[model samples]
Target chain A: MANDNGDDARILRLSEQDNVVVLIQSVPAGERLRLDGQELVMAAGLDLGHKLALRAVPAGETIVKYGAPIGSATADISFGAHVHTHNMKSEYIANYSEDDPYEAEDGS
Target chain B: MINSYLRQDGRKGIRNVVVVAYLVECGHHVARKIAQPFEDREEHDVHVIGFPGCFPNAYADRMMRALTTHPNVGAALLVSLGCESFDGQGLKAHVQASGRPGELMIIQRDGGTRSTVEAGRAWVEEALTTLQGTPRVDMKPNELVVGTICGGSDATSGLTANPAMGRAFDMLVDLGAACIFEETGELIGCEQYMADRAVTPELGQAIVDSVAKAHRHYHTLGHASISVGNAFGGLTTIEEKSMGAYAKSGSAPISGLLKPGDIPPKGGLYLLDMVPDGDVRFGFPSINDTEEIGELIACGAHVVMFSTGRGSVVGSAISPVIKVCANPETFELLWDDMDIDAGRILQGEASLEEVGKEIRNNVLAVAQGTLTNSEDLGHQEFCMKYKRFEPIGPECLPA
Candidate 1:
């Protein structure tokens, strides 16, 4: 949980109670990382600023960040696997995408 | 100490800018034509800001009044289409009452677009000359009102830039500066944490209640506060994006709650409620980043610290926006748009404390007439939309 690499290293655990650690840099699929006195390999490539599950989280469970519930998992999330909108959803409001905001512009 | 323009309202402003406002969408072209001649000139600071709504709205009217008489503005020129419901006369009168020079030109009353543009240009040209005589006074940190907003955010925003900004907010609060952190909609999950940090129990309850109201409102409106850019930048959910956005407020005990156009009563920390009060009658709380930035300026922010990871190239019309870049990659790409690169924390080059001090010093430097990247690039973006907000209650600010 401690690192001399930086105040925040390439992967950072923002709080002790947080169940996920955030990536400060992009990690490849075969990359190795050490957390909680154990070594784990990345299952897939993820970009910088993505999240990695610190431990296995079951579907329907709350996803925790900054020691608080950010939302809920839509599917089972494996440790060191990529966590994103594909696998998780906002609990307060529906999560969807808009391709073009002005789609109905008087239908002209 | 910063040498700043002094307003008769006993407030100090970092910039003495001339503003040309379009009362409705019809007047927009004429207003733009009046201000376009001075856009590239460093000597003349003329900006165009307006509301496009043709229907009369009390919220829009108040916002115009607040912005036209903003401490940073030395004079204002209001252009009206004359048939719109907006009260252009009332807006100009309010500006003049605040001791700033103001003028109104009705396009229908004055000849057409061409004549109104000529009149507005002549008025602004004269106003710029008169603004040269505005008095400059010695101002301290306490007199400075700073506002924070994180836009185009990513996962690194909370870890690197936001907390570093939090550290800067702590330092500014200690210096007796009034700093504001905003948007209850983005702060959905962190309600308890904020409530615990309030100065009083009632204030804490008010803080929690405001978040609850935001949750209900967004749920009713059927739109999430989390933008598509946030998801592409690796922020998954609204709560996840919100926790990152909320970090700019820092650990200061919140002093008060404010709606749009409400000035801070004293020097301390404040939470600006960007959400409207009643049912979701209007559209989204803020349509874009420029609208939020304009609201912060209307609240009397002398300067705004805008932290970004996806990269926003915007600056407000009245106040200079200090862009704090959270991602090193984005910083490299948007070098000309950013002011401070806080991604040093992620790269192991600088700690959060070091970056915090850098942001604090940058705020002071920009306040002392050093132009920010946006200010230098001629980005005076402004917008206002219709919304409803009831005045805050007593418990929101405990003496």
Candidate 2:
């Protein structure tokens, strides 16, 4: 699927098993998109290359990408809502905060 | 068909580079200064690569030998501080035995930094003249080894550049070329999937175990390889980035496992285990992208295909690096540094198969001595630090 311009591009679904679709271009809040014959509205401004939930996800549910669980949502995520670190947490390592030093512990 | 410089060990090199290596931190300045004058010249290509530790390590010694005698290298100059525990003489001897010109310059014996730099420059000039007479032979595609590493990955990486890289890797493997994809720590989430693609069930188990080892090692350090930059770029977790990074391997059955500097016996796909064996004494397996690229070079890769979503402008000292841009936005911002626009796959201007073909053609052009963007920009970045490892087991190399 080729998109001629960023203003009219569609979201990309990587796999049939993936629970989220990635935006090919940034979309502003209130923009309406149709997928699988159903209309969905962007709840917030989403940046390019960011993931949008394909369906409503309950709090604590795992967010799947590339057909594998990447992290769990911290709160209920609605369709077309951006899925990122602010709403999801890694199952492996804790996310870095502003208080942490930027360098690795060993300091190279 | 490509005409390449034929080394004594029945290997062909696309470029005849003279590398000046420093054995310790003290000698790095001298080595760099010696290479500075030749860097701007077109006829003579001089590169500086070295280890900074004063402590003796077998792994470092082996890596030094492998790099100096690499198929693409025709001559070597070893710079050493007087009291460092590294075996500078042994490395020089190995290079000479490979039918390449090798020389050693000790800082203290040569009257300190200024004199040693002057003396090393003189040696390199003579070495370049000697390398000019080296014979060239017809190099086949099967005679080449190619490697891939992903950096600055983002959400677009998994969709565009990496899978396109997989397609290129699959094509190379089909042509009997030795292809490698590495960073076991980055392969944390895809271990089981990777194991299933191994040539042998035993090798598959070994793949799984290696990732398990990396998991435990990183846990003790209280940090994963996932960086804050990765999070900012839309990668929320290590597993998320791993699924993208693992795509560079393509669908070929893994032929064997390799440690740093262990050359593959035959042509196929291989995995370079970057994590240290025994305990995690080296801090992190690789401090940056250059270390990973360095290990790939030591393992005999003639060229590296580096996929970047956020845009990395670094290259290597020994082999050429082809940068494949993953994000269309980043490509727009850094077009000069990128060689291929796999990001076009996202823009709808190109298909994955089309970008894959572009990468394959670029690889052939680079193997035929065309300079990649990184090479043209004079980005000869190199780094190798102290690291400990045990030799590979018989099971690791089943071929």
lDDT of 2 by residue, B1-399 (tens): 878999887789988999999999999999999999998876337999998998888888989999999999999999998899999889989998998999999999989989999999999999999988989899988989999999987768888899899889989898889998999988887776677889998888888777776776676678777787766666777777888888788878899988899998888999999887766677888899999999999999999999998999999998999999999889999999999998887776786678888998899999998999888888889988877776788888786
Task: Tell me how far the alpha carbon of residue A83 in candidate 1 is from the true structure, in angstroms, after superposition.
Answer: 9.3
True contacts kept of each: 0.55, 0.33
lDDT of 2 by residue, A1-108 (tens): 323322234676665577787777677899887655466788877766678788888889988887677789999998767888878877754222223322223311
* DockQ of every candidate structure: 0.28, 0.22
Q: Which ten residues in a row have the lowest lDDT in candidate 2 chain B?
A: B228-237
**Candidate 2 — which residues are off by over 4 angstroms?**
A1-9, A13-20, A29-45, A50-108, B225-238
**RMSD to the native, candidate 1?**
5.8
Clashing pairs in 2: none
Model 1 regions lying over 4 Å from their true place: A1-8, A13-21, A28-47, A50-108, B225-239
Interface RMSD of each: 8.6, 8.0
Error of 2 at A4 (Å): 12
The RMSD of every model to the true structure, in order and in angstroms, is 5.8, 5.4
| Model 2: per-residue Cα lDDT at residue B127 | 92
